[model samples]
Target chain A: MSTVREMLVELTGTPEFADGISDDADLSASGIDSGDLVRLVLLIEQRTGAEVTAEDMDQLTTIADYERFVATRGGAAAQPNGS
Target chain B: MWLTQLAERNRQCFPDRTALVDEHRSVTWAEFDDRTGRLARGLAGLGIRRGDRVAVLSLDRVEVMETYFALARLGALFVPLNHSLTPAEVTGIAQRTGAVAVIGEAALLDRHPDLPVRLRIAMESEEFAALGADGIALPELPDLPDDTPVAILHTSATTGQAKGVTVDHASFRAIALGWLAVARPADDMVLVNCCPLYHGSMVVSLTYMAAGATVVLMPGFKPQTALAAIEKHRATHIWLVPQMLRFLLQAKAMESTDLSTLREVLYGASPMPVDIYTEAAARLGCGFRQVYGMTEVGGPFVTLGPEEHPAPDAVPDLIPAGRVVPGMSARALDDKGEEAAPGTIGEIVVRGPGVMRGYWDDDEATAEITVDGWIRTGDLGYIDRGGLIHLVDRSKDLIIRAGQNVYPTEIERALRTHPAVHDAAVIGTPDPDYGEVPLAYVVADEGTGTAELLRHVAEQLAPYKRPRRIEFIDQVPRNPAGKIVKKLLRG
Candidate 1:
């Protein structure tokens, strides 16, 4: 299965997210808007079956936060180097 | 009076009263005045002069409001670019407006490094914070006429390309007075505004503050944060789009939250689902007011007061957009450019002091939309015997099937009445037999079949108005202002 980082790159459709994007990079700053953020959360819920509530969505600001959020809920483990 | 004078008035009358509250901090009326004054001087130092257009791109923040007032003080036109726009789009708007300066957060600024503007100020940088330093010398304030252009607000572009609607100082002043006359916000009224500041909806916040009411701003609308802010601030009034209200009703925290202080909830930009309105009115125990207006005709010039709201058990009907507020006159115009008879469906046109001056630098487009000092609202509606204006739908959104007119809103409303249907959007799809047919995109709970929804819609609507297809989707695409982007669905 593709890692969360790869999914974000595909979802945002921004080339900048394909390479050298730190896990801590602000998703909003990387061209992800509020509508895009909502879609990302929905995608995560569909794939991981993790219940990301409205409150939880507010705290997931960076790419790493989403990965950890899914992993903590018993989803797939993060790949080394996020390849 | 211009926005600068309004701020100064608030400072003198309610100096110590809270004027603005964001997530991080709150500011008093006096402090807000002082900050804008210094920021105005700082901007002048950057060579921004009267009539200059300055594009601002940033998230909701205290600094954004500061920039608006500061620019208004200098008689410069504030051009707010929607932050969600791509870099190319931002550059395009800046070029179109001939903006000489761009002020925004660092990340947004960095995205468009080659913006045509001559000056760029990052709001997060020390350079920006120092713009409001007390030590900065204040420039002599300009005595701007009320007709001077203040801001160019871009339309939401739900239908097509966004156009910059030029609004003057007189427009805002008229809107403020009109809104105050209708809303009659009390002195102690505290408003929690849930819409983004970039959109024209910011005028609603300014209108409340004009009455010495305190306004709480959010970075963006999140159901949980909005509930918390209302509870923590004891907000007496809240402004949001109907979609936001829906999310608030669905949020897990809503039931546990203390909402006794809420007296009125203002909603607009689209019709409220009768089911949602009934549920909210019962649970929150607050009066609901519907505001109606277009970007071209200032922000909001008509209001459906709380008393006019339908009873919880009342059957859903075509709710009146409202009677035109003071200082504005609205009438339905027939296709021949003549006034339509009462109860006749025609294009709604409004004339008032609050109407926009024109579309920025697009004289042809401006001329096309205006007639005899009246701005065409592009909405089809009619005035009733009681002098209430009822909106039918956007002229472009009306679907014609077999030479019969079919309003998508009517069908969408019918589909929404289904127990399992969460939301629906109807659009015209080209058909060979019928030039166009109504097609629906619906977001519904699991196990809700298209056949079941079709049957429900058929029972409520005429045969011609029923959507030929009901496609299930996870969500209906909408613009930031909560209007369905039907263009996306049609594509």
Candidate 2:
């Protein structure tokens, strides 16, 4: 199964994430807007069966933060490097 | 001499009062005054002179407003670039404005390296803060006429190219005071500004400041953050577009957030969805007002104050386009240019100091929109016996998706750029989340598919401006005049 990082990289379509996005990479600074965030939540929920609450979505500013959020809800354990 | 003078007056009158509070920090009226002054001196030090255009590109922040005031001090025009635009689009705007300098976030500068400007200042760098650091004396404010253009706001036109709205100090001053006269905001109101800095922030926040109220600035409107800011600041008033309010109401945080401090909720930009309006009014337990105006008219010139909004479920929809504010006159003109009888639908025409000087460098287009000192608002509405304007339809071929204006011609122009396309017509379809979203009907080459055409238009326009869906058609319907009959496309 594709890792969370892989899904994000694919969704963003930015090749900079080809090497795998860092756990701490700021998603908002990377141009992931609120609309994009809403889409990302749906993708994560579909892949991991993790329901990201609106409150959790507000706190997940960085990639690692979101990975941890999904893991807590029974998603795949984060592989920061997509190894 | 300029609108910034209000900031100066506020600094003296309420020196120790909180002027602006961002997520990072807060600045008092005195500091806000001093910082903007220093930044003006810094820009002047860069050899930027009066009448030079300075483009500012950034997400909503206090520095953006500071830059606005600083430019006003120097008599320079503020060109706010919508950050959603592509780099090429940004460059095009900068080139058109002939900007002497550009101040933006680091990522923006990196994205648009080709921006034609003599000076580029990165907001995150020490170079930016040093502009307002101590020891550099502030320069004297420029002596300019009230009609001196202070801001150039670009609004999308029917022609597909964005038309720049040149607003002068007189217009801002008039709109700010006139809004207060009409809206009658409570004394000592603390406002949380949740809308984008580029849009109604100036008219709303500045007007509150003019009334000696503290205006808290949100970097961007995330529903949770917006709620937190209001509760934390004990904010008494909040200004937002209906779309943002919808997000706030959907947020789970709304269930628990202490929004008791909120007294007045000002909503506009697009018509408020009745469901969202009713739900928000009940949930927040706050009085709601509807504002109706446009960027071309120097922000809001009409308001349906809280008293006018009926109790929830009192009517199918209680939304009113609002009545003209003091110093503004409105008349609904029929197709023959005569006044429409009361309650008869006609184009809403407005004449006021709030009207813009003219579209920047586009005389023909400016002439088209204005006639006899009255600006054609492009809105079809009727005035009731109560003098409240009720919007029945928008005659402008513009789609308002989530409060952002999307011109069909602009999207159609982008869709035609695809090599596999023949012709395209764009129309607005009703949406639940957004008031309306664009729907594109296309007659395309045999090989082209929906996904390919979608991606093609996405590349040329901002995300909000792109069509939500594309329908393949045999041919685009047009009249003998060769104009696409958009109404048929809607059918």
Candidate 3:
């Protein structure tokens, strides 16, 4: 299972933009623009095969927050489609 | 002071129309006034008086609606706290602003347990039910002066430290009035608002209540629910950020939906990829007006109007945010204080009735931007020969390409056209010969590569203009406010 941050990295191409973000960096403080956040959230859902909604967005302030959100909601059927 | 006063002005002409709505809740002008008057009297009865700052920590509900005008009726400053803020962060702002009261959502006492204060006038659904469930009270009131401090909206805290923008009634009124001139609110002009009430865009939408407009309130934006609200309400005016714009673009029915009632969409909060702007028009019949203004000036001072770009030029060059509004004074100036000749990029400085009085208690920092009363916009832009302003970037975000300037906005706009590229950021990475080269940190859809992106960019740019290096990432770094923090990228 991929970490939520790893899921974010893989889906969003996070390495290009990971310079200053810490695991502790507040989503607002880390400088991830809304555009990036939208893409990252979509990617997590796709990778985990979990349904995410805006109401579910409350806990998405950190990678840990996303991990806990998706990891909990995701199960065996939650895996991304295999080629 | 503004919302309350405007509501009164509107009640005289259109009081019976629906003004505010949520799930299972709706308030008409007459109902709104009765409750607002009662609430203002209620707060006044509790010794909440003029100039007292009240922090509202609640979801977007009718109670929050009453809070805005009720505070305005008493000449108090309204501070709408972002519910998304951590308890500690909320407490920090509350302490810093010296708020006299924080009226929270009556049910959410458990959510924000550590706001550093105990005084809260909680309002909840059941309480509101009891409030007007039988009969609402009407209280006598008079118009408050326009200069009264109506709100202290905090900055988005995207790039640097967050600052409080002390917006006076007059400044707030100027913006709403400006919007009124173009974006009219017919009783049938249903609006779907998903942004936080704290942000000016939501406030702008809520102000349509003054005009008897029906508003579909989505406490926060959920892509599915946002789509549902539009279909149900036949919303005409939808407020959006670019990220939300993308979500709308991706919606299944976006192109096929009966968006006939949709007239115009107002989008801001962050600069968007121009391609995304195109997708919005294609997906929804809504012609968008891209607002370009900062929190200090309250908004939409310069906008890319619905008209297609003048064809003498192409794309963004043709699509520079149109001329300044009637009362506003705008100029592009170089460091030497001389007016930049048309087409010469310089700092955008604005002076007008719409500009805020100053940052709250930040005279020194305020002084740096306000030189002889003209607010230095900090954004680098230029006015063309046709008097339209084209933004380059924020002063700090300017990327020097060899000697030429490469605004990340320009590069981002270019990179968005490639079918495989999702997003891109251009930064000045240190180099030997050029001192600094424009390095592109790019995010591709899935399998796209740096070589393909470089070739894509190379086709559109000169040797000096093309990105010298590429960093592949899963995503670009952005703050909660939807701004790319170059400082973090450099780090």
Candidate 4:
């Protein structure tokens, strides 16, 4: 399955741009603004087959945080695509 | 002191005037000054002090601008991180600057757990809100020299590392003053800034605020949301790159939204397509001006005024970068550094108070670009007999996508990281919507497929920086010194 970071790299369009990004780094610093973040959350929901809400975004500051949140919303379809 | 005084002077002169507005909130000049003062003290209590490098990561918000002014008040350097960069790129900058703290929204901070900093203050968390909620006494604001560094604006280099452009209060103030003198924005003009707040927006938004106008900030550009904001606020001015302008013109809201309130549209970063320009002009019936500047040279230092926009019948192949704005001078220098004759193409160079102090910790780069006092812009253009600056090409391998600068070397470096790739070269191909997009040429190992290479690049780079197409070749031409002949690839 593709990692959340992998998904971000695809969505954002910079090949080496996200290479150094870690789970706790500020995504905003990586140029992911609110609108991008909103879209990212929706994409995560689609791929994981889980509900990734705005409140979840407020709570999940890192991709690691999103990964764990998606884990909690467990199901067979909750796996990220290409995993 | 120059930047800090902007808020203080505005607050004293028009305390109740709305200074800034975003989707969530608005702040009057008085409230802005008081809050920033308190926030500065709060940051001080957290050990932020003079000369501190504070990095801010957030979307477009009043707090972001507040942090900018607050950091200036404390005589600390503000490093506004671009939200679109990768974590490594962000960390590289934060580390390069030795940022004392990274203040941003919690989600952003969460993404980069590895950013080395003394503190990670969540701008929206209860802890941070409490810091501002307590009516803490304002700290002593510093009276900085005009040349004191206020910000470190980052821009990409062909070397794959971003360079930080050190800007002083004087340079930033010069930009605001120069913009005011040139643009002559209405005192009550309400500007809808549709770009990210990290870079050029600072020039556009603050320039308006310096003129005692209110600025409405959009966190990110969405054609519909931008139109709604303009219609809702009765915004008189709007700032966008040509790509966003095209998207806005295509937005469904364009059919019904009342856009008569818009008086001026400022575009820059890349040249606007002739068709897009014509349609936008006809639809908005507003004056359009093109801005030409770079982060390395403070911010915007020149402008193509509304009257100078190309006629519908005229070919927009080489739109002028426009005349130098107030407080700046321009020259087109030949190979030997002599000024190029009018109508002769040369490197576009600028010298002005708005020029940056230098690249942070990059003396070699600083020296290479700054000859005597002029900032070598690296754009190939000529000064026409009528004194208009027309751009023909870029001497530097810089590709402007929409309005964003994308360096091919950075992408080429990413392609080389794949095991199957022997060598890669990237070049810009023109596009109607984005102006230009990267097209990559690859020399790969046996059995390496284009799909595999594409996926490899897609995983490493941001979406915009990724190669739109990959062309496989038997060999890459190079010189004796081993530099790839990019011209042959383009051919």
Q: Over the stretch B1-491, how does candidate 4's per-residue lDDT look in tens digits?
A: 77678888999988998999987899999999988887887888888999999999988888899898888888899999987666877889999999989989787788789999988988887777666556566466667898889889887788878888898889888888987887877767888998787775467777778888889987676666778888888999998888888767755467668898988899888877878888888888888888888887777877888887766556466667788878888889999999999999999998988888898898999999998799998898999888788888899998898777889999999999998888888999987667898898889888887657766765556556767678888888899999989899888
**Which scores higher on TM-score, 3 or 4?**
4
Q: Regarding lDDT, does 2 or 3 come out ahead?
A: 2
Candidate models: Cα lDDT each: 0.79, 0.79, 0.67, 0.80
Chain A: TM-score in each candidate? 0.70, 0.66, 0.71, 0.72
Docking class of 2: incorrect
Look at candidate 1 and give me any clashing residue pairs: none
Share of the reference A-B contacts seen in candidate 3:
0.06
lDDT of 1 by residue, B1-491 (tens): 37888899999999999998988789999999999988988898778999999999887878889999999999999999877665655777888899999999787788779999999999888988888477666577688999999999986333324579999999999999998998887889999998778788788888898888889988766777788889999999999876678667756568778999999999886666666788888888789888887778888988999898887878376668888889999999998989999999999999999999999988988998899988988889999888899888667566644323456877787788998988899999875334567789999999988767765664445344567777899999999999999989989
What DockQ does each listed candidate score?
Answer: 0.08, 0.14, 0.10, 0.08
Error of 4 at B87 (Å): 1.6
For each candidate, what TM-score against the reference? 0.78, 0.91, 0.71, 0.85
Count of clashing residue pairs in every prediction: 0, 0, 18, 37
lDDT of 1 at B479: 94
Give the per-residue lDDT digits (tens) of candidate 2, residues B1-491: 45678888988898999888887678888988988888988888778789999999887777888899899888999999888777767777888888888998887788788888989999888999998577776566677788999999887777666778899998888888888887766657888898777664457777778887888887666776778888889999988888888777766567678898988998888888888888887777778877787887888888888887877767455477778888888889999988898999999998888889998898898899887878998999999887888898888888987778889989999999998888999999997667888898998888777767766765667777877778889999999999999878777
Ranking by DockQ: 2, 3, 1, 4
lDDT of 3 by residue, B124-193 (tens): 6454334323354534454677887888887633222346788887886777666566554455777777
**What ordering of candidates by TM-score runs from best to worst?**
2, 4, 1, 3
- How many Å off is the CA of A45 in candidate 2? 9.8
